[model samples]
Target chain A: MTLTHEPSGSTAVTSPPVVRRRRALTPTRVLAGMVRVAVAVLIIGAALFPLAWMAIAGFKSKQEVVRTPFQFFPEVWRLENYRTILDDPAFVRTLAITGLGAVLFTLLSLTVNSFAAYAFARLDFHFKRALWVVVISTMFIPGMTILLTSFIVVTKLHMLDTLAVLILPGAAAAVHVFFIRQFYLNIPRSLEEAAMIDGCGKFEIFVKLFVPLSKPPFVVVGITSFLVFWNAYVWPVMTITSPDLYQVQQYLATFRSERSSELAMLMAGSTLAAAPVIVLFLIFQRQIIANIKMAGLK
Target chain B: MSTTVTSPPRSADGTPLRAHPPRDDRIAFLMLAPVLILLSIFVIVPTIYAIYLSFFNWSFYQDSEFVGLRNFTNALTDPEFRAAIRRGVLFVLMTLPIQLLLSFLIASFVTGVGKRLGTALKISVYIPTIISAVITSITFALIYEYSGGLLNAVVGLVGIEDQAWIGDVRLALPAIAVPAIWMGLGLMTLIMIAAMLDVPESFYEAAELEGANWWQRTLYITIPQMKNVLLYLLITGFVAAIQQYELPLVMTGGGPLDSTTLPNLFIFNHFRGDTYQGYSIAAALLLFLVLGAISALIFRVLSSEKLVD
Candidate 1:
């Protein structure tokens, strides 16, 4: 039944084990093991050191940041640097706007995306297959290509400089739709079939049955969309001309230019911008990896 | 379909339908309407409009004029646009193979090790991928700073002189590339690891029985099995490199004399400038076409009947 042939059990029994075991400990094997350990260290170090440096730099004083011998940790750890960023009214406004936008985008995107996913996965409809393909194909279209024209659309709708500009356009992502649909497809038909026989309508089945069953995929989509909106820079930068409407990432980008000499301040802003998503990743690392794997398989 | 809709057969209770197929279609359509409409307005319309704008003399102040193919011609001849495209291609060439190779190697190594160690390494590697691109850029910018930069501080311990990593004209692209590769390595590694794990244990066991060494098993058994995932990464990673904007925008500002000006940045610059909007739109569309063609070509080349598959 398997697609590829497996080595027969007789071959495993007949193989010379002791000779091969001795051969495996040759100098090349030892050298290879050493190389592997070295590479592992290098990989882990490369991944971790920049993050560690950023965290340490966030606490260092401006003087200590650029001082000779390059202070790895602050000589005098300053909480004031983070305080400076946190106290700024503009930073507060940016965080509020970004947070609200992310929440709205997540709620809206998850609701709509899951509805469409359930429809595509469970319900029979005209052009269901064709429409699903269309949705999936849009996932391949690069965001940058249509960005300018989309900005124009937003402006025409008078959404420019409004949080709606951020939330509405991103409210229906193809990737989330595809991810949720894949999850929905795996749910057994028997559950929905049984529900239908109990006099539940499609919408009822969707709300009571589908929604209750697919919480993990929904959370993955919610977190993903939230992260995108929270971390969004290019769209907000293009559309948000009003200083009051700046998102955190845009605010931080500008903050870097305005105070380029203040390394500690900049790192503090980076930490603020990066922390929540990092925490989210930590909590849902397994689900995030699964989501990515799902994306790849498509 | 029309027969079912127009004059449905009566059910046992003399109802028009039993399961209500037409009603189900209607409900499905209702469920699908929001996303479908939003996608149309945001994605489909803008795509068509971008193509339309490519053929016009249009901007905020300028009067609209339909000048077919002129914008495309101008983009082709524009030196700055050409340089941007060349730099983008260079970035892709420089980063993709390095990231893919490193990620694949790390993934293989991580899988070969014990489970707890593998999980620890995976978590550490994957941490950066979740961080925003802007934050990563700023972090690296500080790290790339010449005088008190972390990289220089480390290298100086070994007596290497401090060099302006992002400030130097030749080094800026690669400097930007360092963070780009680092940010992506985690996700790539994870994807590769997942793909590697999909190579069935039986294949490895069988290969071991035949006296195949580790390298041989990887080459003959693992890689061949992971071709689709590898190709998937190849195309998507290539497309991502083509659209790169945020890292270079924040880190180098496409700087040290435009060494890292990706095509997306070029388009953004043109969009900001009043006169060059047409050229930007035209180039953006062209870049889209080029990306599509390249992805298709990759799919075609790698999708030829593999000996094992």
Candidate 2:
């Protein structure tokens, strides 16, 4: 159906193939292309400039950073800045804590949310529609509204100032459930039917059949959950008081607040903190883009 | 729903039909149980507790005293709270429109270019969105530092007296907004550009045949087609901008006369303070109600028009 419409529409509209092809190469077209190039460059430049500058400043001495009207490159590189940040026990501890938090939260969220999505997509049960709506409604509740109550709960449970609290509350994200459910709905039902005919139980079908075929969405959920949990600042900062339990973002904030004058160390810490996510993005660029498209589609 | 049973067709084995109830009900509930339990304990339960706590003057170290509606009354009447609301509204007003317009312009320009270039541009724009807000705040802090800062050096070159960008009470909020706007610009641009690209090519082709210039094509075919996406962006942007906490927290700490104290920061300070325990909880509750109401109103308006669909 798609191909039929394209060729038919093209043929019906144009018989002047040579003239039209020539028009495509006209001065107007060339000017248009050049303008597009310029615009692209400007857009790209705006996005990358700050990040590039941040990375460069990380390697520059404190004096070099503010010495002038922003020199693009530092005269003398200071690798010691990175070493100093790395050598700090607190810095290393926070990094481990953040990684641990991100990994634990990601795993827990994936299991719980993916299962919930499976139910929403494939099941017919009492209050199914109402339950789905209720879950989705939670997404509209701004995180700020629940901060106080969550704090009370955490304190009441006596789980405050621990990494467990950080990881546990985030395990029940409504948005992740919604995203995965929408993705599950898009999967064809034929696979499920085939599995059922082979005498596979519903749970087994989900694990052996649905789960195997759902790599893309799982990756999307995993990556996004990892990012959100890793970048979490306000929650971890509020709940975890000990420097030992502080996540990377919280640690960075503390570093900035305490060493306001140490620009090089701060920048180096920031660079190290952001490196893992950047590496993940670089490796899974296509999956990330596809995931974004999937999100927007819903 | 009705269940019907039919006899199995006789095969060589002559197997009888098996009437098994749909397994989906059991499986669905099973799948959803863990998530529901977690959410109930962490999110839903906390929310209910927060509402309960808001009505009282409950401190961490003292006996709980119930003073119904007093905290809400105080929050409404307090000048600082009111000022925070005003500043938040102003910040939203300043940031959302400018960011949206800039992002849309950038996105539209990139989409008009070819796919390869457009993809590269989109990635560059999206990179900043991925960088932690802490990094952006620090970067801007360096840029806005009063003495020997990049901004000061630039002002010096222009023969203007160097002014403190973030330290000045009057300029602190706006200075904070610069980084917020910059951090958000790329993601907003990518989304807008994606929406613009979703417009059917036939619309542009038709406009071209009618001798519509580039501007006309963009206005008629592009803008109109992206109305839904624009509305989504506007509402989401408004909500996000109002709740802005990271930049102001990291860079200004709502300092220099409370110029940059957003509602979230106010709530954070209250919750973080050891003395104001119950009052902080109360304040957070009040803030949540106001924000929730605003969000609901926006969502209602947008959904009423079916903008999301």
Candidate 3:
């Protein structure tokens, strides 16, 4: 009887009008959106500032660069800076070396890592799990930790000054293998079984069936491997002593080391060096992001 | 290679073979031969050789002598070596947290903004990552240079006197760290953003039903869900921070009284310098051991928490 208050409680059900009054844009939501916009702008700005500065400075005269109150845009853009950097014999040679090295490294690594990954993913053998564990474990070993040893090995093999030293040591990245293996694991095994029923050996099955289905992972590996090989400095700097053998990054390092005062030329060289990688990134941004996600999931 | 050819086995259905072809281990060996040989020659064997060389008193110009722990003893006791470790650790401390935090914040924001804008922002963030570190270091060097540098110009507009960012020992390491953090921020941010995006939208929807605001959603849902990615970034960042070399090498030359000298640079200098090959090997070994220990700790923590996923 005490709980029979439905007649008065019926008013509580008619609260839509009051709730509608409270549905306007609140100061809190507006502030939050504004804050998000500001942060986004700031982060993007900070990320692009150096690249923009470098690009602009590449066109500025040496005197104009160091003058007080820097100019964001050059008054007289020096087209000669680009011409000068491009025409430099050493610069051209370094670019060729870097280009060839990156292409070769990518091709070799893609083949090796993909095959190894296929074997690990599909094959049944003794110590298979243990071997996979060993391979993946190498991912955690920092490259610098093996620098001296790598150098010694390269020296002993008489590959010290060759691009082979740069390309060969990085041929078997455990992470790349793990990445490709994970992708391979997700493929339907029925395709491989069908190939086997058709008398296609493992190698033929991998080539005819698996490789055709795995273009995305291949592109991811190719682009990433190219980027890693292209940007490599420490190993190249350590192993390569001659100017002709230097990769793009090593060449840039030497350029900066020698001509600390030549701001225009340095900036020009920096722009050229950055162009290839930036272009590659623009082309494969989606694949790169996907690969990064896959890497994390592993 | 022919061993597999000699061994015979029944088929899966246990049929007697009419024509048993030689089992070719060659293909299996062929599949793995290149990588195995390369790894042994380049990685495994060299590692063994480095361990062997660490026990000697060798010189680059002359034959090495077996010194038996002398180099390690010296490295353990040397003030310069200790100072290098201290500086290396300091460099890691200076760069890692800032890089991780900035990357995380940018990632969170970019992911929060859905679709086209997020994609654009992610692309922009990743551009610097693809650019070589040497280029970034040189760009920053230009910015930090005393004369008409961008940094000085900015500081001047703020009504402060210009200072030599990379020339002064006190500021050199941090100045170098700035470029490193900048270069690293992009990749990590893109990575974390991708990871954050993978956190199912249903989590946020559920949290919203619980009256969770953006901050609460990020804290209770996003961060917890993306712990593995964060941990990956942290561990990798820490390792990468310690391995810092190219920036200091190109920008500062480990200069201004060795204020910016890292362990890798120390090893490189030892190798290139006169008559210290043995010492260099020992130092490199010690550095490897330290790196191994740190990696082991990370592996242990990650495994214990099952955070690698």
Candidate 4:
């Protein structure tokens, strides 16, 4: 075959002819390409339309939202829905709880997971393999099965209905540690050895050397942890009953039935609750995708 | 990176402190202490307790009674439990292929398009994935709302009557799955794209030179290259589907004759009830074991994927 004779050479030679062939497509090929684009557009549109509609409706009056032959955009962009949401003490408390809880838990989990990851990746210790096996084994266990027991544990600890229940349980995750460990494993050991020669301690080496070099993964893990705190729904709702300690997600979940009847107010709540994470995602799309790809590599 | 460690200046004990091996163990333990403690209490203990609790008549308010195999046996005969499992499996069977195929198509399309265009399309899709489940679920519930809902509005355009999407018994499960399929598209696409890019260009080049068409080359080369990634997605997707909750729980609330009630929702409901807590635990434990075995099988492929590399 021509492939065996000149694999690289033929590829090099085929580009122009292929482009010319594509430029002079038969009716079928043209239709095929158009169909491909059309399907892609349709999928993208479907994916985005609901989100866009939620945002648009968030700014509309309730009467407009329930009107037949739906209004795509509000004639008058009303801030009343948002004002109503913001005026609720429960909403304010939830926002604080979610925002503050995310910050605390993200920081705490990142510290714990990073230390564990570094130890696994770089350090030699007794039962290193055994401890790692124990830690990584939990990844196989679904969190749903443990939900009831975890509730029992938290209740026994006298933490139910408190922010502690929400913040403490997710303070460490096996997968985050696993991802960070993979990144740490790829670091050159000589970087640490060189630091040792310079009279740096292990903590210093980790802080000054490994931490700086591993910022991207750290950021990835941070965002992931922050989201764990932010977007957590089922667990928080199951545990925290007090509106005063409710996280934003649990607060949002409460908008069903009675509250969801005020469709505009509900959309406004959904939009506000969704804004931070969505904005973060838009800002860090590249880093997030690259981090996820790194995960696949591991 | 040299494996050899450099000796630092001597300490008061006449040891090169920086190069000392025992300190590594101490430091490692010290660093790992907080996580191991938390995990032991939350993850490890809860897991073992769940297994133990499955055999007992347990609830929050009452003293748990040891029931031996009663809970497990009851689960075997329970119609609600069986229906939940069936619905969960049906949901997975329905959604997985649709999600995977659509994601694969989008991933390939993104790769084939120009850079700016690809980025725009990719972002548009991924936007849905990052939003909180509560937001997406609520948004979809509104979209599926009967009166002045988005789905109704769109169908009305084509002269079709506005149907009760989430309220209709026959349509509830599938209606709930639509948002799931939409939300899942982004992450799956990203994963497949990464997997596709990892395939060596030379394989495609060689196939093309051999007169293999685009689809043929994709079939013989691209698909094989992506085998493990696809398997990874399959395992995770299937496992997540098995544990499906939150979305349908929020969207349909397992309503319209309990048509959308999934295994997890069944577990949640029974657990929430005064009695049947033991039954719920048994169901959850069984689901856990089944998922664990499936995950183990796929994890082997993941490891072998590395081996092949």
Candidate 5:
């Protein structure tokens, strides 16, 4: 009754993920499909309820948001809230700072990670063994454990309250180096070899042969890093004191805490903060999802 | 794949194509120096400094006094520290199982349907994960409002009285955990769906031919085949849930008689301008060791354990 051997022996060499369909339309089969579709609707509903509720509440009038009987949709939509928030200079600045830091972090980390990953993936050096241990071992060392001391370290270096504290401390993450390195290893060496035979230097070879060929991983990791920076809360809270310097998540937290009673304001701010990441996720979702599934397959 | 990527470095069969002349070694060093120097300054130095600070009564203001293990001893006996550890464990207990079960059931259905519908379900379930937890908590806060909230509104239809979710001590922890659990569902479900879809349909066909009912077929085939993925998710979930800082910090503020004061918040309470900063560093180090041991044990099990049905 073992299936490990039976599956490989099947005559049908179907493509992946081909669920065997019931050939005849039995009543039980129809019922099962109906039940599954019903569950899908429910699962999607539960997953999206809170976010949809927030967006809906953002459009409600001040008095209508907390009305005793809940209205699923606002009676009179308040589009002015979005307009006012967008017109506010301070709010615009917060979005700008958040975007600036996220873009900087993504770009800087990609270079640092690709360089280090390239070294490990393609180079041979004297201390390659010991150096790799030095790099990768730090992956297990929890960032929380080092938070207090890292704060002290950054403060001594005079990085507190600056964008450097946000961008640089996270720039050379061991995990990214490892992830990109794993991707780098999968690429065929022949391309690089051909470039090498063309009398191209190592840097030239990497630029020509590797960078152009490695767009997918860069996109995947770049998007991931950007969202991570955008969503960062704890470190920015600890390091930055100025309201002007607050990142997107920090701004959302401050908005809700200082104005917890104003349901409309909080929802509007939360929705705004969630907007960019949401848009980005929708845009690159195909690649992101394919990467996630590929991660599982690996 | 392991998120930590702690697999040992490969044997020197690595660089056969590229010749490693002295000039190449210099180039390699130049490329690696950024990662190496940053690691030393940030990660390596801080880890060593944390251990160093655990011995001394370090403070931002006054001269730090050297006390031999007094901080550790104080943290060990501290009631708040014990409760924080327990709450951290409580989060893992409350969230991981329910998320796994929900993911399993949801994935089974999603993968069963047509492909386009399945993709739509996956995207809807996963969209929330991309949003920041701080925003998610705010969204949850409105939903968990004492009056006119969605939860209360729904329950009122069932003739149940409205509940103070984050305001009540008994409900605060679970309330704080809900948004976090919800945020995690997309990733877990996506991972689960991938794993479930990977299981060969022929196996189920064989079981059906053997007269195995749907439930029995799942038990004998699907569950056993998905064990490694399940275990992987469990370990990652444990690690992730225990680090639950943002949700509780945002939703409940660790309030209602400190009912939701998680371990990280507990550490923050001490380290952020408290006189007991030394004790906080020590406690953090202690938690690190415990988590480190657990992670190591997981790696051991992952590498060595044979699959059995």
Candidate 6:
């Protein structure tokens, strides 16, 4: 983290992946080889530094974090910070609330979005044009711009501080519908025709054929949706007034004010908020990259 | 493609296929009704509600008289609102170009490397993307602390003094942009990588055959070919930048004298205050119109960045 990842751009020369392994590692290539190694090292270190720093800071004592002549390594490696966060009912409840909200929002939103996507992509319907216009028109309105009014609307609907306020308002994204519809539209009509010939109804065809086939796009959209719902802060801040309803970010928002001097604990809370998503990302890395390739290349 | 619903097959084969069923309007409607209701409640109604409420001099749950376009005029003239908009634009300036450049370079470098190292770098860069903005802010808060923070420790290695990153006006906005850029870096890099790969290895090989250095190759060929994705990213990233609320809220709470207060955070603060609810809603609507216009322009310039054709 001492350096940004710019100088590593020296790998600038051989950046196309296909050509990366094609070069020979011979004596003639010493300078180029050294540069490549430098690039690799810098990219890894620079990218991981902030996260690594946060993780490490969790191990330091409160005083050690702000200790004079700042030490890079903590004097003591503490596990108590993690334990402390997990033990706090407020913190743990934030995790549970956020986890449940994200999963349910993902499933609910994807189902509805895919339903809408299928309708636009494969089926002909009355009001299709009008409905598509309605969804697509609001596609780019930044949620921040609507925060107060969304509060007013949800309050008017009597949903403020309820769990439904968290999940339902954001469950039907126009962008998701658009993304999934783009995917659905790309599936060959012959597959749908064959399914139709087998006497399957439109709904059945969507469930069996389209749903299964759309996995790659679903993975991409699903992971993103989960992250969006999990990381959601602005709306939750406006609506969830009760401490019990705090999402992960909601808790993080209050961290400085609630436990001001506990740097280690703050770091622990940040790590807890971040770690699960990192694990999810690592497990899904190959799929995320692969599906993106499929989406882009196909 | 819509013709698939009614028109006959494009190719004739020996395969026997029955005629397609009539249009599935009822089935489609059944499927779409739930989301439509949700969308109407959340997206549509809030938007229209915001517009309607913008005209009134109403406070929280208060029955008040309509004030015509006074709120709009007042918001436009309000020094804080104007300053916040300026800061939002300033942030976009500070963040976007660096993000575009760094992500582009990192994207090229990471994707170019061997499998083991590439995977390592890829995961590391993208880690920040998944972390919530609030958590990112919380992490960076400690890092940007005036005394004995991580950033100062790093800077001290080069003999710079300990700096009040988010506390000082000059550094506060830039300080917030750091985490913003870091969080967005991975996704943009991933996007850039995909676009770079789509440029075809033939283009790079041809440049290499002509004795162009890698820097020149990237500058002349790689950058040019990826313009559409870059432009798409720039525009969308701009919109995202302007909407930044979390960092300022969690980090500096609008910073020393509102230097870091972005337009959204400005609205959010007014939203908390009991008196200016109507004006906040009006300001929100105006911002909405501007963003909606930019988004429309983006959609028109490039199809919707599935980066669609």
Worst 10 residues of 3 chain B by lDDT: B13-22
For candidate 2, lDDT tens digit of each residue in A1-298?
Answer: 0000111122211111121233557888789778767777777777777777677888988777766455757787779899998999988988887888889888988899889978877775666666776776676666777887777788898998887888888787777776666567666788789888989887897798778866666776787778888888888877888877878998888887787778877888888998888887777665555345313331
Q: How do all models score by TM-score?
A: 0.88, 0.88, 0.87, 0.89, 0.91, 0.90
lDDT of each: 0.79, 0.74, 0.75, 0.78, 0.79, 0.79
lDDT of 5 at A263: 77
For model 4, residues A225-281, the per-residue Cα lDDT tens digits are: 887789998888788887778888777777766675688998998888888888888
The candidate with the higher TM-score, 3 or 6, is 6
Clashing pairs in 2: none
Alpha-carbon runs more than 4 Å astray in model 6:
A1-16, A20-28, A292-298, B1-22, B304-309
lDDT of 3 by residue, A133-170 (tens): 66666665556556677776788789988878889998
TM-score attained by chain A of model 3 = 0.85
Off by over 4 Å in 4: A1-40, A294-298, B1-23, B304-309
Model 4: per-residue lDDT, tens digit, B98-170? Answer: 9998888777776666555666777788788777778888888888878877789988999999899989999
Give model 5's TM-score versus the native structure.
0.91
Stretches > 4 Å off in candidate 5: A1-16, A19-27, A293-297, B1-23, B296-309
Candidate 6 structure quality by residue, lDDT tens digits, B185-294? 87787777767766877887888899999899989998889887787788878988898888899888897889999999998888887575789888888998998899
lDDT of 6 by residue, A1-298 (tens): 0000111221332234644346676787888778988987887787778888898998888888888888888877988888887899889888998899899988988899899989988886566666787888877777867777787788888998988998998888877787778777677899889988999999999999999987765776778788888888878877888988888887877777877998888888888888888888888776565444222221
lDDT of 5 by residue, A131-194 (tens): 8767867877777899989999999999989999999888888767766776677777888888
Model 2 chain B: weakest 10-residue lDDT segment is: B9-18
lDDT of 5 by residue, B255-276 (tens): 8888988998888767775874
How would you class the docking of model 4? acceptable
Best by DockQ: 5
Clashing pairs in 4: none
